[model samples]
Target: MSDKGLFISFEGIDGSGKSTQARLLADHLRDAGRDVILTREPGGSPGAEEIRALVLQGDPDRWSAETEILLFTAARRDHLERTIRPALAAGKVVICDRFADSTRMYQGLSRGDLRGVVDRLHDLMIGVEPDLTILIDMDPTEGLSRALSRKGAEERFEDFGEDLQKAMRAGFLALADEFADRFRVVDGARAVDDVASDVRAVADGFLPKRRV
Candidate 1:
């Protein structure tokens, strides 16, 4: 953890409601008069957003697994420089929708054998992990159903189908175990408000109280 502020990241399979939870947490923290920045990846800063469009749009196979990993790392570096790091330096609670964990799961899943490559690249370039990471766990079938209902060009990942999503879910759960110190698993199958409240409480425990 940084000495100045909280860096909380929300991580989960697509449609696990992690994105929504991240947003709600940011809002809740802001309401308590905390300095907060809500951002996301593949694109959080300008350069990252451009990279996001490239990665998330176009045909599903627009980039090969190795190339996709490189692009994601590039965007993440830009995000760390232009957005996340600076905000933390200024003593703001920075809530990121997804971080390197997504890269690990998505890219590693691509080749199954490429996970080592992904980890090595992350260590070589983007070495920082969030101070706290919330992993929203959900049933893949339900998550896929929700994900498909949303219309967007970003449907490239969703097109991978439920089996892949289930595998990803297991991967994410495994990650929570692997990085237990900084990761918390939340059941995303619950009601939104229930999940939101749980998220708020968990984050509140980690954050320092605002000064009068």
Candidate 2:
């Protein structure tokens, strides 16, 4: 936890139901009377949202791996300054849809062998890690199928297709191992509620007791 607040992030390959689960967890915590701020990366603040459209839309090759790294870092800086840090300072529970780990996988491993670049930039610009990161693990084939069905405009990463999704799945799992202390892997292959139930259970173990 940072600044007396609980910071939680959810991650998985695209269409792995992480977004839905993040929202559900936010709702659950709110019902339990915790102050919660649910937001997403690359778009939590206005400035970052603009950058999000640039990076998340258009062709998959819209930007080179090196260039995407800079753009994402900039967006994250603004997001941290304007959204995440302030929420934490207020002692609210911050549930993010995706965070730096997504960049570590997408731009770091997926596009090229530039993980060092991503890490260096992150350490320099935004140095905060979530208190807990919930990784919704799913089968790549199933995840890709679900992602394509969305037909959303922010499908640039999804447009990379199944092989990338498979790679992302493996990379994310490796990341969980690397950051094992804070990463919790939940099976996303199950029904949404079942997955959420597991996620809630995992989160409860980390959450502090409610204030009197």
Candidate 3:
């Protein structure tokens, strides 16, 4: 990790507006003259993109819980090596829409254990933890409804019933409690600008003496 760069990740269940908030934070930082790189997990690199498509679009029956976790970690490893790490090394703040936290929530909801997966990936990736992680917390049912209302299609995970989404949201909250110092939970049900302002506040607190 470069001393001059800050790594921030935005995480939440579907339709919690993580992508929007991530872009807003990156724009705020860039306008303040900080070099910024906005990216997403399960992607951000060629190899990772392929893995993303496979995981998101492939046959649901073909992927077990353990296999899903491994695939996510594999994509994350590539993303870190090819994109996130290099950007941070160059002193650019990196804003990722989702990172290792998603794996913990999604896989933990499905498989019931994420400690081994998280530990193994952290070791292999050489401690690429985010300086700040903003989780846009919301009711899973509401979030999923929003997601389905906005996007007409569903991926393998999104295809899961509402109960699964609720489980995932609970998993996220549990993980946030486990990493309270590094995680911030935002009210995702608020208006876009309100949520954006909250995100800006959290990010500005970690940035190098800047304003949003």
**Ten-residue stretch with the least lDDT total in model 3:** 150-159
Over 86-128, each residue of candidate 1 has an lDDT whose tens digit, in order, gives: 9989999999999999988898774466888999999999888
For each candidate, what TM-score against the reference?
0.97, 0.99, 0.92
lDDT of the structure predicted as candidate 3: 0.83
* Model 1 weakest lDDT span, ten residues long: 107-116
Largest lDDT belongs to which candidate? 2
**Residue-wise C-alpha lDDT for candidate 2, range 48-79, written one tens digit per residue:** 99999999999988899999999999999999
Stretches off by above 4 angstroms in model 2 are: none
Model 3 stretches astray by more than 4 angstroms: 1-3, 152-154, 210-212
Best by TM-score: 2
Give the lDDT of residue 184 in candidate 3: 95
Pairs that collide, model 2: none
